[model samples]
Target chain A: MKILVVDDEADIQPLFLQHFRKELRHHDFEFDFALSGEEALEYLKGNSLEVVLILSDINMPGMSGIDLLSKIRQDYNYLSPVVMMITAYGDEENYKQAMEKGADDFLTKPLDFNLLKEKLKKVMNNG
Target chain B: MNFDYILLLIVFSYLRRALQSKILLPKIDKYLAIGFWFSIVLLIAGFFLKFTKEINAWIAHAMLFTLIYFCLTQKEFKSVKSFIYSILPFVVVNFIEDCIELINSPFHDEWNNYFDTAIFFSIVWFFAMFFITRKQRKEMEKEQLKAIEFEKEFQQSEILKAKLETQVAERTAEILGQKEKLQKALDKLKTTQVQLIQSEKMASLGELTAGIAHEIQNPLNFVNNFSEVSSELLDEMNEEIVKGDFEEVKNIAIDLKKNLEKINFHGKRADSIVKGMLQHSRIGNNVKEPTNINKLADEYLRLAYHGFRAKDKSFNADLVTDFDENLPKINVLTQEIGRVLLNLFTNAFYATHQKQKKSGETYKPMVSVKTELKGKGIEITVKDNGIGIPEAIKDKIMQPFFTTKPTGEGTGLGLSLSYDIIVKAHGGTITIDSRENDYTVFTIFLPTE
Candidate 1:
């Protein structure tokens, strides 16, 4: 199974890689990285790639995470994929907006990787 | 014949009275009265002296001249001409008698004929005096009538002058009263304007808060989360050590070290956020004072609407203020908060104006401000019926420099700065609710304490 991560912050890459090292080694789960919402859309265009789960950051320079989530839902959510939004601040306003835009789930930074793992395990089981 | 002393005495007595009348009237303290009596006695002694007939006749003429002079002093006789006319009959009779005496060889012979001629002259003198006195009385009557007319005119003028003075005083007082009322109204207007300007300055703080929160909160989260996870990892390491898993312990040690590095990085990020927030807030430095929140909001609402009108002449809006009269006075930096209100009102006006342009004459641009007493504090809302923010960019609205307005019109830092003022400085919250084509409402909550 392949999980896609979209974020503007370069540091998030290393953090996630270290956090999911065990899962990457033991389970047959592959990870892909996209710097922005536009970049993620480009990667999704490939006919061979099967992106099952998408993790996106809400705030960015262009094509914010919320916009990316809406576009994914409108175009490809029926293809057995789940999208979860990440907000910098755990404000209820942003949380509600993400949910209204068809986000499956949302979390705040610095992300609790343990909780995220538990949720992902559920996604992995369903997929 | 007669000794003629009796006639001489009678004539002299009459002369003495006329001369006495020529002397000035005696003052109340008559110091010279004794001297006058003594002179009278000398005149009587001269009558007994047995002097020559010529001497007696000369003395008698002197007395007659003195009598004429006395008659001149009478109040009825004014100028020298009138005096001469008054004594003319007496003087003429005396002159005729003197001529007769000269013809009779001396004044002594004329004395024998004096009684009959004197009686004839006395009749003439009485007639002249009667006419002169009658004329004088007529002149006096005319003078009295003129004095009465002058008194009446003077009284009328005095009454007119008094009336005009009172009227002038009443008019002056009326003008002063009007001036005082006008000054009071002007003072009220100026105070309202000042409060509005203060709120305008604070509006920028909200946008600054949004930027600062996003930048710092994300890193702070990382620090907190990594620290908590590291502690949990230590317990896992303890469990592994009990099993004598040496390799697993080494991996856990490496993971803990990496977590500490991230904690350090995010900790520094949080520190910088605090520094930046302080720096930004300092720019809005103002001393707090007891403030009426309702008055502040209402004033800014009017000022903003007028400000928009000044920029675009065609722009107009129905501005409304619904203030809670029961709200208590709160301690606040009046100018800073006034600035925030000004910014919000200005944005509201701008939104309404833009909508008016799109919707034409049928659309009425409306902007309203409301202040209400809330839990231990106050709440203010600015609402506008105009162009609402699009949903896609709603989350970005509070971020610094994110504006839908064209360049030169909006810096887009207004909402962000207002957010900073309310949340960071005042321990308050700012929220927004909007529909795409309907309305935009910004609600602010402030704590009293």
Candidate 2:
């Protein structure tokens, strides 16, 4: 399985890498990182690999996660990727927007690895 | 004794007539004078005809009648006095005639017969004058009695006028006291209004502070996240450098490219928060511009709740959108409206979360935000199913510094500042409807044209 993670936070990638590397022994998964929405779009344009999961953070400086999600939905609404939104604040408006932008699930952070793993299992099955 | 009594009675009759003239017939001095002379003539005729008993008895009766008349007419005593003065000369002349008849009794024989006649005439004249004087004295007594009654009445009227004046003074004092109390109440009301205004101003400042903290914190989180990643990349690079592994260093260098890009990403975020703050706090400059409300509301609502989430990772609300495609843009301050939306969404979350915390009643609270075109205006509604507002506190919630939230969680100016932004600043309206434990909806209307 291949996953694309779009976040402005550099620390988030390592956190994911550490958690995923410890959990998955099959070595069947590959990970890609984009620091911003524009970079994420650029990376999508360059890559031909089929990505199954996309985890994104909504707030960023320019071309926010919502905008990126909107663009992604516009381009590939039919793609059955399990897109999960990771955020620090647990407000309804953002959750609603993320879903409207074609996000499949939502997770709030202090980075619970166990919860993420459970959510990934469900999302992978669904995908 | 009979002649003396007759004279006294006649004299009293004349006095009564004189007093009556003075009191009742004051305007008819001529008639009073004629009547006095006529009485004197009757006295003289009585002596000549030898009718002393008849004349004396009639005079005695007339005297009593005159006294009664004088008593009745004594109310006009001043006029009666003038009439009596006018008859004074005639009374003296009659007295002189009486004296002459009395003195001629000294001659004897032929004079003795004359002397006897003159003595009777003299006695009749003297009695008539005596009766007039007695009547005058009684009339004077009657006049004095009337004067006493008038004096008593005058004193009573004076007392009444004095009492009325005192009452007027008391009423004036009472009215002045009431006016003073009203003025004091008015002063207290003015002070209370001023305090309310002052506290409202302070609350706005507090909201601005909290908003700044919240906005800036988003970028700070990014900074913290990015910095940790960059430090890890550097640590890996250092390990590759110490081992003198050029091929691994090249791969790490390529890996560091994405982490370096994150520095730019997080830096720009911090800049935007500062910029939003600058725009939000700019005062006294009218920067109202035409803005699409639907776009603004959707964007800010998302941003306001950008990082919020549920504890159960599976739960998510169904979002329904109903944007009016025909709605025209309106002149507005975008950042102000953004702040207003932020406050509203924050309140919605607070309400819904509280409901979720309550035992046995944890129905997944739904928040609906809708926009509609309403006759040259736009109506936006933010509705939530949560612990709703109470009727008693509904009106007070719009007042500044009034909060239902726990301490440190609320500044209480959220709705009030939102009220000011929509209604006072934009010339729009904000209305709230809520039922306990059912739903709370805030509707805002802004003119499109």
Candidate 3:
């Protein structure tokens, strides 16, 4: 399975890679990274079929996670990948908006890698 | 002869008493009394000795003339008109008596009846003179009573005037005391105002606390994650070393080293954020220190944005910063200048947020901060693409207690206090340029010296 992780913080890339190093090394999962929602969208446009899941942070500079989610749902409805939103604030409003906009799951920082791996396995099995 | 002397005595005594009481000339009064006594002695001698009638009459006339002289010489009667009116009666009477005696000597039996008539007329004239002197005395007494009343009224008025002056003095002292009390109260109020301003600075810091937490959280998250990864990498390295895979062990070692570096980097990031927060909230002595303007502006810009974001999670803006790299450090009150920058950045974010709410998705909120090295000074510019300040309120924005924010949402002292910090405290100049519904730019210029 291939996953795209989008966050404005550049360090998230390395952290995610290190946490999933076994899966990445075993060829069980492949990872792509984008620094922002805009970059995520650009990545999805070029390589939408290869990515099976999208993990994105909600707070970003140019385009937000919700905006990106809605845009992806509207533009790529036929190739809809599972989209999960990550946020520092786990407030009801953001959760409601993300759910309403078709988010498959929600996560809050600091991310628990064990739980995240379990969720990723579930998604892999479902897909 | 004795009767004639007695009659003259009676007339002289009456005149003396009347003049003595009214004119009040002590010397004249003594003389008049002595003359009266002398006249009495003359009468006694006339009775004792067998004097001729003519001689007796002559002696009586001499005594009468002496008394009249005394009365006429009195100050009250010294005027010719008064003397003629009062003493002329006695003089005419004496003249008539002398003429009658002289006529009787020529025709004794025939003039005897005329002599008696003349004596009766002289007696009437003396009575008239006595009455006139009594009326004059009464008039003088009335004048003296009026003068005494006038003196009494004058003395009472003087007492009243003195009382009024004293009252006025007391009232003046009282007013001065009240003024001094008011001045003291005003000074106390001024000190209270200074304390309130310090609290306001703390309040702004309180507003930034949520943002500061978020800022620190990001780095903290990285620190935790990186350390955990490094520990895992160590475990992997240990396993690889046991498996005798030197290449993989070296790779794990490199990864571990990178993770450690990241942890250090993120730790320092968190430390700087905390240090900035401390500097902002510090109640320093307004001491000027060499400071980098760009770093100050950039730190505050991020802080204000994050602070705004923490409050309204949906709100976001494009933060653009243009800092002069070669700019020299200038002396400034660091905390004060930081506050000024925070205030400006916060206002910019607020303005853009408000415009976003109104204009919806069509409006992109943008706040840009720029610092430049101008000649002899530095300039800082904060620009916002939002609902700009209206022309009518542009001039009032920097005045204390002037605000566009809703009640309880703002204390309205942000810009005013910033103005004080930038302009008065640091000898800087702040100016605003804005167009309603378009944009706003706040520029501050601080001298290097």
Candidate 4:
């Protein structure tokens, strides 16, 4: 399975890779990273079929996570990648908006790697 | 003649008493009293011992001379118009006596009785004249007494008026001194009031702590995540070393080192943010230092944006900045200029936020900051596409305690304090350009030398 992780924080790339080192080593999952929602869209446009999962941060300058989510759901709906929103704020409004915009799951920071692995396994089994 | 002389002695005594009482002529009064008593004694002696006509006439003439001498010796009596009248009776009696004596010598027995009756009638008429003159003198003396009393009263009143004027002058000087003291106190109070308002402005900046906390969270998140990742990478490195795979261990070690560097970077980022906040909250030392205007403008702009974001999570606006790279560092009180920038940015954000709420999705709230190197100085402008300031209140925006915001929502001292900081403290100029419901631009010029 291939995954796309989108966040404004550049450190998120190394942190994600380290957390999923075993899966990356075994070639069980292939990961790509983008620093912003705009870069995420550009990545999706090039490799929409290869990416099965999209994990995106909600808060970002220029384009927000909700905007990205709605764009993906509207523009690339047929590709049908499982979208999960990650945010510092786990407020009910953000959760409801994410759910309404076709988010498959929600995650709050600081992210629990164990739970994230379990969710990824579930998505792998479902896919 | 003897009756007339006795009457003249009585009238002279009465005149002396009147002069003493009304005009206070003690010396003349004593002389008149002595002459009157002596004449009485002489006349009584003549009546008892039968003194001859020659001796009797000599005593009467001597008494008349004494009375005239007393009256003439007093300067007060000499000035009176009534003095002549007082002496006329004595003169007439003496003249009539001489005439009768002369006529009797020519026809001694035949005309003696007729001449005696004529002398007696002449004495009666002069006596009446003397009484009338005495009454007139008394009235004139009473008028003179009234004039003296009036003169004394006028002198006393003049002294009292002088005393009152002096007191008034003293009181006026005292009042002027008090007025000066009050004016100084008022000036001191005004300065203290300005300081209090300045502190109040700082207190409002304290509200930015919430936004700072939010800002700190981002770097803190990275620090936590990177540390966790580094720990996991260390565990993997140990496992690879146990497997005798030196290449994989080196790779893990490199990853760990990168993670540590990231942790350090993020930690320092958080530190700088905290330091910036502390600098803003602390009171300024009012010392001028060479500072990069661009960096100051950018830092405050972010602070204001994040501060607003922390309050209204739904609010977001495009923050556009065009800082001049070639601009020279200018001398300014860092905290004071920072405060001015923060105020302008915060106000811009507020205006846009308000317009966003009212105009909804159609309004794209935008705040832009630009710095340029104008002639002899640096020019900074903060422009906002928000609900612009109304034309009527444009000039009043920089007045202390003047606000268009709802009560309690704003301190209203933001622009006023900014105005003071830029114009008064730093010797800069701040100007505003705004149009209702369109846009607002605040331009500041700080000279460099």
Candidate 5:
């Protein structure tokens, strides 16, 4: 399975990479990264990667995770990749909006890698 | 007339001077001056040897002039009686001189008898004048004293009245000052009331959000778990079918039945999350109860951190807990304090997170929560290794709507509400200590009883 992780923060990339390095080594999967929702959308276009899961942070500077999720649900229905949202905010309104935009999962920070793994595994297996 | 008579007149002057110096003393000097002038004129007239009767008449006239001068020099001139008293001594001297002349006369005739009668009539007039002058002087002195007493009384009353008025004015000013202070306090109270209402509204909203999230997450977790298990079973079935293992495929179908039973398990979880939300939104509920502090603190801290983790996959913070095991249970509204703790922890994480971003430093940011039992009170300290609060803003941080966080980054009511909860509601104290570029500690002391 191929997963695309979208977040605007450069520091978050390293943090995520540090936590998932062992998992990356063990799993028969590849993870792609995008610094913005626009970049994630652009990467999806003309790309031959068989991406099965999407993990994105909600509070991006441009094009939030919810917007990307809605776009994917509306425009890329054929792909049908499972979408998981990450956010620094844990407010219910955001959770509701994300679910309404077709997000398969929602997580608030400081994210526990174990929980994230369980969620990702479950989402990918289901997808 | 005689030495005794002269002694008696001098005694009268002395007594009058002692009783009323203002009435008697004015004529004293003038009488002495006239007496010396009349004695010199009497000796000179005798040496010249004028008609014996004529010389005696001259002496009488001189003596009368001296008496008239004494009368003019007297303090009181109220009536003719005062004038007669002034001349009474001169009249006695003249009658004695006339009796001596009558006894020594060369011819013993009726002329002597006429002289004696004239002297008798003068003595009667002098006595009448003397009594009238004494009455008039006494009246004048009494009236003068009465006027003086009335004037002194009027002056004293005026002074007392002025003093009383001044005291009243001072008291009035003091009352006005107190009224102004009370007015200012009332204004402050009104402002605080408005702020309290606004904070309560926000707190209610936070409670609703937390409940809704809990409800949604429960069912969501089960759906996620069940779906993964089903997908795994399907994958296993597909794998066995590809390997042409008919027995393995049949076995997988049986396993699928057990996974189906778990489907309702996840459904029930989703239902509970929904139920929690409904309960949270309901108003006027009796939710307050005596809660175990150590247990609640641990559970709520876990929930708060995990709740945040449920959103951002990459967000992480180092948290340390040192709860006192022996601390007594506290009575509180559990949900409200839980929300407060969540807010503090979230803010601590963000503050450190922002610093880490700015410094580009790889150091681990630590947030430590510690509880201790001290006497009848429990102290909870939350310390964070974040960009410490500035000295200038330390006092203002607990003020409502005061924040250094960027807009949308914070609601700016966390510390303020936390302060109110601990101080006003729980009868506790919350104090903050911070060192710039080092760390910040928030200490809360709540009574056990």
Candidate 6:
């Protein structure tokens, strides 16, 4: 499975790669990282719908995670990625924002990777 | 005859007749006034002077007394008492004259022969004294009438002065009343101005808080996600160590150390957010600029919806927006107005979300935003299918610190701050329409010009 991670911070790339080490070794998952929503959109322009999953951070430098979700819902909705939004506040506002923009799931930080993994498995199983 | 002599005879005839009429003389049958005058002339010309001289001075006194009685007894005189009073001065004069005559007669026997002269002088003196007393009395009566007329005029002026004073007092009271009313109106205006200022403060605070919330949440996302994944990595390393996989364990520790770095980085990022919050507040000045209101409203509405979904995954709602194609861009404070839109959209979603909870899956939560062209301005409406605001709290919804959301869930400043931004700052209007358990719609009117 190919997955995309969109965040403004550079630190997230290393963290995501390390966490998914077992899956990558087994060829169970492949990952791509974009520093911003604009970068993510640029990358997707070349490789449309190749990534099946999208994990995004709500706050970003240029276009926000919600904006990316909206663009994805608009352009890639026919053969779309399962989009999930991550939030730090666990604030209801961001939760509703993610859902309103067609987010398939949402997680609050400090994220419980176990819960995230379980949710991913369920989405994957359901898909 | 000479003219003077004839005129004097005619005058004497009239005077003699006048005296005869006063003495109750008999009237003739025809031309009685002429007959009396002719008879008086004949009697006087032929006999009066002769008889007056032959008669004693006592008989002359009796004739004069009768003339006086007739004159005084006239209707205009009112009483004969005054005619009798005329005799007093005459009687005193008569006594003085008699004493002089008696002394003169003893000194000169010729005084008896000149007695006619004495009588004539005494009669002239008596008449002159009577005329002087009458003239003095008439003068006294004229002065009394003048005093009465002056008193009447004084009384009329006093009444006029009193009326003028009443009018002046009434006009003074009217002016004081107008001044008092103006003061009260000024006081009311000041109160409204104060309320507007307070609302502005609340709006600024709301904008600042949203900034702080958005800034801090991102780093925290990183910090929390890395910490959560770290323990799982440690577990993996422990399992790898049991399999004697030292290289894998080393890789796991490195991953764990990297994760810790991320946590540290994001932790500091959150700390920096605190400093940034202060800076945000200090720098916040609402400056208006040209903005496409439709794009702005759409963006904030999406943000609000997603933010709500992030907190409660089970919560769901449909958001719809209808934008006028002809709507023009207008100048506005972007951040402040953005905060107001965010707050309104948030409330719409929250209300519907609450209703969805009670009504279950059959209930479809829907929130809509609509913008239209309204003369000289734009009208935006935010509507939702939700458990409506109760009638009791409706009026107070825009008041500061008044909230229906439970204790920790809401600060209750959302609507009030939004009210300040849209209505006070923008010189706009906000009105609400709602029904219990039905729906709520908030209409906003903003001037484009």
Tens-digit lDDT track of model 2 for A1-127: 6788988767677656745642444554578899987888898776624877878877654456777777887876676566788776667878887887788888775556667778777766765
- Per-model TM-score of chain A alone? 0.93, 0.89, 0.97, 0.97, 0.89, 0.93
Question: lDDT by residue for model 6 over B156-239, one digit each (tens)?
Answer: 888888988998899899999989999999999888665654554454445445545655666777777788678788888889
The ten-residue window of minimal lDDT in model 4 chain B covers: B79-88
Model 2, residue A93: what's the lDDT?
A: 77
lDDT of each: 0.70, 0.66, 0.84, 0.81, 0.65, 0.71
Q: Which docking category, incorrect, acceptable, medium or high, applies to candidate 3?
A: medium
Candidate 3 lDDT for residue B218 = 93
TM-score against truth, every candidate? 0.47, 0.46, 0.76, 0.80, 0.46, 0.43
Clashes of 1: 23
Write the residue-wise lDDT of candidate 3 on A1-127 in tens digits: 9999999999998888888888999987899999888899899889999999999999887688888899889988788799999998889888999999999999999998889999999999888
In terms of lDDT, the best-performing candidate is 3
lDDT of 3 at B247: 98
Q: Per-residue alpha-carbon lDDT of model 5 for B1-449, expressed as tens digits?
A: 23223433443343344435345545654554455455545545545755553654655554554545444564443233355454555465565555566676554343666555655656555557656666766887888888888888988899989999999999999999999999999999988765664555455445335434643554454455545655666876898899999997886677566556555765775575455434434443445577676765665454454454444433445567898888767777665565556567666666666666667635556777888998778888878888889899999999877888788645677788788878887788888899877788888888876
Candidate 3 chain A: 10-residue stretch with minimal lDDT: A59-68
Instruction: Name the runs in model 5 displaced over 4 angstroms.
Output: A1-127, B1-191, B197-288, B298-315, B319-328, B332-340, B361-363, B372-377, B390-403, B406-435
For B1-449, candidate 1 gives per-residue lDDT tens digits of 11122333443343334334236443411322433443354456556665544454544555545545544675522433343454556555654565566577455464756745674665466567657765885797788888888888888888998888898899899989999988998998888655543343443445334544556666776777677767777887898899999898898899889889988988887785566345334544567779889876764554455445445433546667788999898988776677678778878877877887798867877888888998888999889998988899989988877888888567776788778878887899999999977999999998999
User: Could you tell me the fnat of model 1?
Assistant: 0.27
lDDT, ranked from best to worst:
3, 4, 6, 1, 2, 5
Measured with C-alpha atoms, the lDDT of residue A25 in candidate 5 is: 57
In candidate 1 chain B, where is summed lDDT lowest over 10 consecutive residues?
B1-10
In model 5, the number of clashes is: 14
TM-score, ranked from best to worst: 4, 3, 1, 2, 5, 6
